[model samples]
Target chain A: MLSENSDKIQLFKYLEGIFTELEQQKIALDKSAIVAFTDIKGNITYVNDKFCEISQYSREELLGQNHRIINSGYHEPKFFRNLWKTIARGNIWSDDIRNRAKDGSYYWVATTIVPYLDASGKPYQYVSIRFDITKQKNQELELVRRSKQLEDFCFIVSHNLRAPLSNLLLLTSMIQESDDSEEQKELIGRLVKPVHLLNETFNELVESLQIRQDTDIEKVNLSFKDCLENAMEALNVAVLYPDIEVHHDFNEVPDLKYPKKYLDSIFQNLLSNAIKYQSPKRKLQIRIKSYLREGSTWLEFADNGLGINMKVQGHKLFGLRKTFHDNPDAKGFGLFITKSQIEAVGGMIYAESTQGRGTTFFIKFNAK
Target chain B: MPNDPMKTIDTLYLIDDDDTYQFIVQRTLNSLNLVNSIKLFSNGKAAIDFLEATLHDIEQIPDVILLDLTMPIMDGWQFLEQYLRFRPRIGKKVVIFVVSSSIDPRDMQRAKSISEVTDYIIKPLTKSKLISMLHESLES
Candidate 1:
């Protein structure tokens, strides 16, 4: 009987030794806060290294304490009250929280609190896991501030510059009306050309500013055919040269919901440009067609004109104040504004050109 | 000036802010013997106020209104709005021409849209264009 009793005692000691080994392994493997306890008062009995690292307190300090040790003043009293209410009712709580460190600096953490029950199925201690995300939050805030500053700068430049520009244009008109001789008129025209150029430069600058600042998009139902008709009407006089021919194919798509005026402007600019930059050897042929693919509409304007060398001008095609063709009327603003207006309405435009062959503009629109 | 047969217009309204522009236009009209009387206003508002007060009086109404688009106190658009309101009271269809140097397509579109605007003449309004405008006005 004495030998049997000793054997039972040795077996119990062996089982206790196994449990100690398992606990040590858990502590080493876990990268999150781990706490162990019984059901009665819910006090922490065991705390891991990660728990001590996050809380900035030693295991001796946190072992007997509850979760109130790392409670940040950032959260309201109601926050903890609600948190305790959720966990006490046998529910797990997962949330993002701001916690205070030992040095009083605040840190953002994504936390998940899981409730553990004792052997009798009664509520016990909780285990929490957290990850730091303070850096990401700061970046988002900085981006918003910078965007607002850019918007303010755009508004001021647009308003102030336009006012003086309008006055200058008016003054030029009045001068033309005056009784100036032929010699004087010629000289005035020379002066006026430079003023016009200055105005064009200012317009390009404003357009660039607008492109950066104006991102809010409003959608409306618009007729594609009507937009084309309007653009043709506006450019009728300019494109009346005997060398230009415009063809349309709108059988596949009819109408689209977009910013109507912008669409017209884009069409007018591109169509006129095709005529303006036509090859001297051949007549201008602009073929406009639309097709549907993958639930989106694609419109193409293929032009037989002074084709661009992609190697040299590809990067600068849509850039502000960039002129490629030798056409005297080219202010280099048409494509820049066209692209901006297209993008502003949540559409996309791309160009494909081969030197001496022609250029084809592929515009994609999100179908309504 | 009133007895001069060549000066047919009763009152000439020059609604422009620029002193130099106003002086040049007034001098041109005087040289051409276009009007018996010339009334100059620095901006659209002063002209608007004068016209709105005298619109009911036939003797006070100007035969022509030369409007400039951009001004400080009131623009040509504001003046047009006021003129349109008092249009019927004046009895005659006052010849209104948009005299602007603005080559902006948007501005040109606006001028073309308005029925009251007889012509969308671009800047440096020449003597020949003004003469043609007068001839068309008389013929109509």
Candidate 2:
């Protein structure tokens, strides 16, 4: 009886040791990972400090709430349904989930949910262990975007380069065959335009590539009025567009930190496009405005000119060599270059237009 | 195919965005004596619109179409999709050949996959290539 009592005591001590080890492991996991417990119906029951920290929700707010409270809506319904189906069958489900925080900021987490089963092998509760993977996920997305950009770059280069180059080849071949002096002279004259076009295309492409690579170009704080005047002076817009009327309101956001050349180029391109595409029925009118929204400075240019069909041409508006209108001077380079410049420094540019009415271009500058 | 002694296509359509290409191709056709009459369209949309308008007129319909792949309004692929829809309505056999500066194998493969396309020709279409295209159109 004494030995049996001793055996019971020994078993109890071993059980206590195992319990202590398990508690320590739980503590370590809680410190490193976002941990949450939910009932079979996916209602949050418990959450660790890390979970509250990452999700930007208090423990009080999280408990009794559904996991959908933090749902980013990036994933489809089928994704969640599949996950729930897996865990419902007392199986583990794992995936990278993008969750929205209390402040509406997005974060990605590598999540693993294990279902705790009852005696009948049915899930009673679920324990989700998630590690913050936002940084890596963003990097992966950026890499994919960059690769796609490179692919487009290659396609444009090959396609645009070939057109002129092939024309040069054909023109030279014809010139070689022509014995008549007058015909040879005309063919050579014809050769001049293609050569000029090739040079322009090559130069434009190089300029765009340079802008993309020169992300760290020097920026200076400059007045909006001054920048506009500088672009006008550079383009000789006052002389070139004598009848063009310009209006401005920079009271709300007067100055911006940007690369001088890029800003000037963007202004020049937009101004020239507006002027060149003005409707024959109406005089050219331009309105420039600056404001602040969501910690970013915005510059808006609204033009009363010949607007294009946004539905059909919007997607290709900023694409290289994509012209919607039959304007003889449209090389389709202005918007593409402007977009590249803006995007180089984490800025964005978009347009809204109604056909035959007008166009408004909005530029959102990076807060940094 | 052997040189068929300067054979001519009855009516040929040249659809391309590049005016330089249009000029050079027209000149080449004249020099080679390959086409009786040429109709030019700047893009696929214009060409397709012309075809839709002239469906019943056998005289207006092109005997051969030299289609460029990349254009502003509608590309060659989109043109093919639209063409396939109404192609059966046209009574005459109209052969399409993709004439593109794109050397991308995917473009060639896609053009070849279209049963309506007779062939895919890379740009700076040589004298021999133009002659062979003429023979193909004549036979069709």
Using DockQ, give the best candidate's number.
2
For model 2, residues A1-368, the per-residue Cα lDDT tens digits are: 99999999999999999999999999999999999999988899999999999889999999999989999999999999999999998889999999999999999999999999999999999999999999999999999998886776676677777878888998899899989999999889888777877787777778887996787799999889998898788778888778889899999999989998888888888888888878889999999999999999999999989898999989877877633223434555778999989999899999999989999999998865
Off by over 4 Å in 2: A64-66, A84-91, A117-123, A213-260, A289-299, A308-316, A319-329, A342-348, A364-368, B2-7, B44-53, B69-88, B102-115, B119-122
Report the C-alpha lDDT of model 1 over B1-140, residue by residue, as the tens digit: 22434546667688876554565567567867767788898788899899888877777787777887866558888898888887777887578778765555566789878888888876566656666665555444
lDDT of 1 at A215: 63
Compute the lDDT of residue A205 as modeled in candidate 1: 65
Interface RMSD against the true structure, candidate 1:
12.7
Second chain TM-score for model 2 = 0.92
Over the stretch A248-295, how does candidate 1's per-residue lDDT look in tens digits? 888887777676657777788887778776788788888998888788
* Candidate 2's DockQ: 0.44
Model 1 complex DockQ against the native:
0.01
The native-contact fractions of the candidates, in order shown, are 0.00, 0.41
Lowest summed lDDT across 10 adjacent residues in model 2 chain B is found at B1-10
